[model samples]
Structures are given as structure tokens and as C-alpha cells.
Target: MSAAPHIPVLLRPLLTACAPVRGTWVDGTFGAGGYARGLIEAGAAKVIGIDRDPLAHRMAEEWLPGFHGTIVLREGTFSELDRIAADAGAEQVAGVVLDLGISSMQIDIAERGFSFQKDAPLDMRMSQSGESARDIVNGADEGTLADILYLYGEERASRRIARAIVAARPVDTTLALAEIVARCLPRQKPGEKHPATRTFQALRIAVNDEYGELAQGLEAAERALAPGGLLAVVSFHSVEDRMVKRFLQLRAGRMGQGSRYAPLAEAEAPAFEAVTKKAIEPDAEELASNPRARSAKLRVARRTAAPAGRVSEQEIGMPILNTSRTTGGGRPRR
Candidate 1:
């Protein structure tokens, strides 16, 4: 089997925050089985690993058998944790870790079409079971496509990039998209980042519905955790990190608004206590060793006895973008 691609970002902090001794733990993303393997190695009684990617499921099945703890790998999104936990007979998970965004394996594999650097097909679905990137770029309206790039990638030149993309209709390849995007930006300096990077990121996030999944997954994690349970997440971009930060702040009653003298109406007991006031970034050593670790930010929170809102597994299936799937070289209505 191929070696696991993920480096398991924020391992020490995640384990420390979760602190699983003998209870059940969940690795929601289970990319490369890194977090699951780490939790098991750290002495959890049982570890349940879940991923939407069928490839990840197969990899875990092949690799996690001889791990120290009892390992159970399931195939599904983290937003469906309730079903995963129920099926595994785990009453309450003591710890849950979600390493958000695509794993290194996906980016490194050129055929997955996750990176702008490599020439590959334009297919970026994480589950490998949905509409491909080709379906979106080649089908979606220019405005809808531009909005996705701006919101997901935080790219300032989104309109120009989207215009270029639309002008080049029936763009069926990764390099084709990347080259078009590159044309919209200034010529790169020797050490400057690739202009197509953000555009590719935007496409990947839209293709995978990653941020949407994260929101649902975070809410699900809160619901699935027992009192005093932990939820740990590592995000590689600002959009995700902001969500994690805001969610924790809102849950912990840490949002700075009114004064203590003002009597505030009692809300549901805060569901989480933020373990890291600010998200943690990798150290110099880690950053130097793995450049992919550069953008990663880890946020962790412990569950309170307080009630949390419910999130359904079906919610993840909702359409986030207005794009249509077209097959005959015609634009699909937004």
C-alpha cells in the first residue's frame, strides 16, 4: 500500500487538548489515518475513523489493523458522525479531531486534479462520487463562478479570473484552467507564489463543498461529543479558521460585546470552552520540514454539559452552489 500522505498536523496539541485515556475517540477526517493512529497510539480504548473518500477508507482498512488500539474505519462524511458512532456502538466519543481541507495525498496525485502546478484532469470531488471540477467551471454562470472564487479562495482578482475562465469554454483540463488564470495576473517574480494557486484553491473548495461540510461537521461534532469531550480541528485557510474561531467564541460565551455589569439573559450553557484562544501554527522545525504545514492552524475546544443545536446528516447533501451539470458544450443555467 502507498504510504499515508498526511503529516497529522497539530498532533501534540490535539492529543493534549483531547487527553483520551480509556474512552472512545473519533478521527473525523482520518486522512492518511494520521490522527486515528495517533489517538490509538496515545492509549484510547477505541478509535473510530471516518472519511468520505473511499480511497482513504481502503487505506485505513489496510493499514490500521495492527495499530495498538481498537480501530474502526467507516466510509462517510464527518457530518454524519451520529450514524457512524451509533453503528460503531460508541455511546459518547471522548475526543474528536477534524483536520479540515484536502490531504497532501490528493494534491500530490496529479490525476486527482487538486493542484495547479501539475497537469491533470479537472476532477476534484473528495468523495470521487459527485460532479467533477469540469462540471462546475465548464457549466456554471460567470457570476456564480466568480462568487465562489472570491468567497472560498479570498481572491481579489476573481472576476478577471472568472471572465478568463468563461471565455475559454469547454476547458477540460487542470493546466488549461491554470494557464487561463495565470493570464489574468502579473508576471510572477522569481520567488513569488503562483498566480493560479488561489484560483485552483477556489475551484477545489467549491468542487468539494469543503467549507459547507466543515460547518455541518463542526456542529455535528458538538452534538456528538459528551460533556467534557473535546473537538479539535486544523484548518489550512482563513475561511475555515474564521468559522472555527467564531464557533468556539460564540459557544464559550467569549464574544466581547456587553459588559459584565449588564445582566444578560441566560443562554444555553456554553457548549464549548476554547482550548486555544488563538489558533496554533506549526513551529519552525515543522514548517521547514513540510512546507504544506505553513498555512495550517489548529483550534481545539472542550465540550460543556450545555445543550447544542442538532445537525442532520442529510444537511450535507444540500446544494451550496447554483451551478448545473452540462454535457453537450452548452452553458447550464445558474
Candidate 2:
């Protein structure tokens, strides 16, 4: 029954884009219930809130009741949102809203180990179970660690960072790992991001299998949404934004034709029509109010009458990692 700590990033524009919101909607991420409350207050008949993190559900206990049953909180990941919605008695949802990446609530808590600023156990599991950052840093091979940093974080000195991490085995704390990474790189210039930022981001993404989850969740959203239902996603980084953008482009038949020599294959009917041709960033006012809103981008699209169909992970530009060994704890065999 308390107010959300802060307004969700790009929520105003998301609601504006998906105006006249009605029927059952699914808040896929459901972190802190900001979007769910916004939808309910904006006119959604009901909202099925889903999250993998138990903390998110526990936090909701205080304020969810204030919605008077308008929002139904579910314990699960958005990758299985379709099943989650069905179990909640919503066969088809009118809209699906996903706020990707770690939430402010998760980052602010030192024990969560998401922030390098606060030293804590190197645990960054979103679901609070499975492999942790500690396991990855202490176990994964050098090459695999390098790939994760390069592909996920776009870090230019991934090899050097990975080498440093491997040499400094048993890195048990956030600050320890951050210091190791910072030592490998040059001192940051004024206004430059911390050296450990990319390394931490890469480790967190790997620990949570965030890219894999995003690909599956996008496909699940396609299936769960009713015809004309809207699918809106807010991504904080380029990797996530690219995946969402390409998925919409391919689904909406916006992909361009191939060159004369190499003909493009025909695609199925458009599954969705873009509501925002380009990603929508927060306005200056929002940025001033919430500095975290700076990098966030919101993209929305409306489902077509076409039947729900699956899109290949490659088609959506999903970042594929060698998850067989490196992701779990062991080195891949030659």
C-alpha cells in the first residue's frame, strides 16, 4: 500500500503509445510493480504480473493488495509467460510489457552483488538460484570468459580482463573482481565509465542467461498476445535493444530484399506492426528526474491477425554463447 520508490523508465511514453489500454495485460518483468500499477491505473482490466525473482514477489506483498485484485502476481520467468498467463486464467493477454535488465531495487541492495560500488558476495543470480558470478569467475576457462565479456559487454579489452580474472582465481567478492578488472585497464578519464562496468555486466548477464531469456521471452510474448495486442519492451543496453528491434523488424516484414545475386527467401505474413518506428528514449524532464532513465529505450508494436509463429534465435540477432560448459562451471573439452 506504499508508493513505488520511483516511476519506471519510459513508462509515460509506453502508456501513451499503447493508449486506451484495456483487457488483461501481462507485466513480464514485474520488478517493483511500477508498470503493473501504471497499467492498472491507466485502464487495464487486469494485469498478470510475472517475475522470476522471489524478492520481487515479497516486495509486492506490501502494495499489490492495494490494487484490490486488479493485479495478480505470479512466480516465474517471462520466458514462460504464456504458460504463466494461462495458469492465471488469462488465455490471451491484451498487452505484454517487459522492462529488461536488473531493476533499481536489485542494484541498490549490496548483498545482491550487482553493483561494484558496494562490496559483497559475487552472486548475481536473478532467480536467486543456479550458477552465480562467483562460480563463473572461479571456474570458467579463459577463452570462454573472454567471449562473454566481448560478446555481451562489447568490452574491447576482454582478453586482458579475462586473463587477469583467471590469474586471480577464487575472486569471491564484487569489489575484488572490480579491482582486478580495473587494474588490467588504464585509469578512467573524467566522465568515463568505470573500468569494471563491462566486466560486471558481462558476468551478471552470463549468470542469469539474460540473452537466452530475452529471446525466449520475446517469442513467448508473440504467442501470449491476442490479435491487436501490444508488445512493449524497455531495454537498457544495446544488445537487448538490438534483439528487440530486429525481432520486430523481421516479424513486421521490414527486412529488406537481398542483393540481385542472392535472392531473399519469402517470409510469412507480418505478425506485428511497429507502433514506434524507432526506439523511444526518455525526455529531458524524465532524465532530470531519474538519471537511470538516460540509457533506456522503449519499443512497441501491435500484433496482427496472423497466427502466432516462432522466429529463429539467429533471426532475432540473439547473442549465442557456448553455454554447454562455460556457463555452468566446467571448461569445454577440446
Candidate 3:
């Protein structure tokens, strides 16, 4: 038999919201089949699993038989959840769970190029095929790199990091990039994390177009979920968490409807209810076991019985800055 699926963080809360009883559920990330296994254990009739990573797809094929529920694994991004769910004959899915972040398996595998601590090719694409992080690092201009770090990684020293990266061109491996970033910043005296951690995060986010996928995925989930269905998203960083938080808030009719006093036509309520007023973080036990869980925040919302509504492509309303390169002055990394 295949190895056990990694234990998902916040599994109890996710299962509580999802309540996977005898109905179809979607495990959008399917990272190491953790949440999917839980759904099966909770007595789901069938589980439709989707992942962008080919490695994850292979894992699902190998390990899904261990679960009780019928499993269907698809090699695709969650952004296409509607199509995938429909194609699987899973219209109006009872639940959809998205665990947003790199899987532990991916980080453990050095060839995937996700962990900064490892020495491997600078590739961070979630899909098996895509432009790698090495391409972006070597090709992007200082401005473009800085914007990526700032917007995605929320790094305040984006400009400094960008300048350092551009100066040290053709950073081919994880360690090379990490070392450059570490050198640019002051050495951590003790009990401090690597300075390149944020830089690696920014690069991975850019390489995978994570936020973009998430925006589309949220819309797809809204469309695919059945009335009263649950939509739970676990985000590991601010960028992903912000997207989930805003998406749910917008769906719950909190995104300032146009012109309250202009005699607007009576419109139906949106097709979702906020399950949790605020995002939920992992508990002490989960954090103790997996330090990665410390950064994870889970937000769940239930689909309303109303007809589905059109969601704007620009759900977040923040300007998605163009990722093109620019010729700009460099700053020293501090």
C-alpha cells in the first residue's frame, strides 16, 4: 500500500464546516490527500480531488484506495473547479475545501525547488509544466521583482531584495538565491529564521501565480457549491488569506453595493453566508506539531439557497500590478 497521506492542519474545523455525509465533496488542493482522507473517514459518498501538481495526482492514484470513499483525482488547477466538478458529474457539490500553500511533500522533495533551505533547481511551479522561478529571477527587472516581493510576500524590503537579486543575476538554485538574500541582510544572531524566507515565498508566489488562481478558484467554488454547501479555505500566508477573506466578505453582501439611495432595483441576496465572522487559526497542538500551521488561517462560508450571481473577475478590487520588468535604481538590502 502507499504511504499515509500527510495529516492536514485544522482537520477538525474543516470537517465540522464541511460535514461530509453521503454527498459529493471537492478537495481542491489535495495536497498529499490529507483532507480528502478525512472527508472519506467522515463518510463522504464520493470525493473529487483536484491538484495542479502532477506529483500530487500521482500520489492520489497511489494512495486513494486506502480511503473508504470513492475517489476521483484530476490533474488541474482549482480555478477550473466548475468545469472539473461538472465533468465529474458532480453538479452542486456538497462541499469544497482548499488548503492554500505548498505541501510538505513538495518542500521535502528537493527537485521541486520550494524550500530555501534545500539546494535544488530554482523551480517553483505548482503544475508540472510552467515557467520556473529561475526564469523569473534571471529574466525579470528590478522593479518587477520588487513588486512581486512586496505585493505577494508582503516584504517591506522588496526594493532591497530586488536590487540584490538583479545584481546577482542567473541565480540558478535555491541555495544560491538564499545565500544572496542572507548576505544582503544582517546575520541572525540566534534563534532567528533565515532572511531569505520571505524572498523565497515571493518567488514561489510569482512563479505559480497563486493569488490569481485563488481569485478564480473562489469564483468557481461559489458557482459549483450546492445550496447550503460549505466552502472552507485554509490559507498559509497573508496574500492567500487576504484573498479568501475578501472573497467571502464580498459574497456575504458586505462589499458596498452601488448607490444605496439611487432607487436601485430590488436584487436577491448573494449565494453564500459567512460561516465564521473571522478567519480561524490553528490551535496550540497543531502549531506545536507543525510550525507551518502557525501561519495557516482557515475561513469557511456556506452557500445560500439563492441563485448564483456573477462575480467580477477583479474580485479583490486591488490593482493587480503588471508583472513586467522595469529599469529602476537599486537599493542596498538591509
Error of 3 at 176 (Å): 0.9
- lDDT (Cα, tens digit) per residue for candidate 1, span 128-149: 8778889889888888778777
What's the CA RMSD for each of the models? 4.7, 2.8, 4.8
Question: What is the Å distance of residue 125 in model 2 from its true position?
Answer: 0.7
RMSD of 1: 4.7
CA lDDT of every candidate: 0.77, 0.89, 0.79
99-158 in candidate 2: lDDT tens per residue? 999898888888888989878999998889988999888888999899899988899999
**lDDT (10s digit) by residue, model 3, range 1-334:** 2233376989887777656455888999987887877887798888899988878877666667766448888888898998899999988898899998788888888888888766889988888676888888888788888897787677788899889999989789999999888877888779787888888887787777676677788989989999888899998877677678777777787776567667655656877888888888888888887776887888989999877666553666432646434221111111
Please estimate how well model 1 matches the true structure, expressed as its whole-model Cα lDDT.
0.77
Query: TM-scores for all candidates?
Result: 0.88, 0.95, 0.90
- Total residue pair clashes for candidate 2: 2
TM-score of 1: 0.88
TM-score of 2: 0.95
By lDDT, the best candidate is: 2
